[model samples]
Target: MISKWNILTRRKMRGVYIIAVFTTILLGLASRKFSHLLIPFIANNAGDFIWAMMVYFGFRFLFVHKGLLFAILLSFLFSFGIEFSQFYQADWMNQIRETLLGALILGKGFLTVDLIRYTAGILIAAVFDKRYSS
Candidate 1:
């Protein structure tokens, strides 16, 4: 029998997953390319939004039956976990942060304001997902 986790693996949501992937990439590139044009608030926190969406999409793509609130919660928990991880500052962790990908994923520093950005991103993602799913 098919399970809830198997829902996302089916072809029905392929388009949703593809769109999420593209949107995530576009947001990431746009954040970098237009950083100069954006205000400090947007420029500094845009990545948090993208990160939240990435996590949201990831959960929707895996646990397709899960609800919007679930996605939002999972994304926030994960983003917060990663942001909090920045406080470790161990030698190995710092070494990882030195790399481009690592820095992008783990972040160089912790900012409390980032939590808001992550929430906004997940909420936006949930809205979009609800719209598209219907």
Candidate 2:
């Protein structure tokens, strides 16, 4: 049987994976370096969107040919998991969130509104991925 791994390893997908990684890095850097120049609204909201985009790319990397719906579902779940993880505030976990990389990945706190932003991000990514992959 044709497997999901086969779909992910196709030659064409390599470029998409590379692009996703590049875009994720660029967004991370922008969120860190350029955030100060953005207006407060955009600055505050951008991280949630970018995090979702990164999760979408991760889903794409894993499932490749599984298509947009799967990617959206997986990305939303992963994003929600990370956001929800913030509620567990132990010393080790708090220390992890204090570090720069950990802060980027785990986040320091949960925002109820982040769920909306994550859904928006995943949907926007699905539209973009469908348009491109078709």
lDDT of each: 0.82, 0.82
Q: Write the per-residue lDDT of candidate 2 for residues 59-89, one digit (tens) a residue.
A: 8877776767888888888999999999999
The TM-score measured for candidate 1 stands at: 0.83
Pairing residues by index, what is the TM-score of model 2?
A: 0.87
Worst 10-residue lDDT window for candidate 1 reads: 6-15
For model 1, how big is the CA root-mean-square deviation?
Answer: 2.9
Tell me which residue pairs clash in candidate 2: none
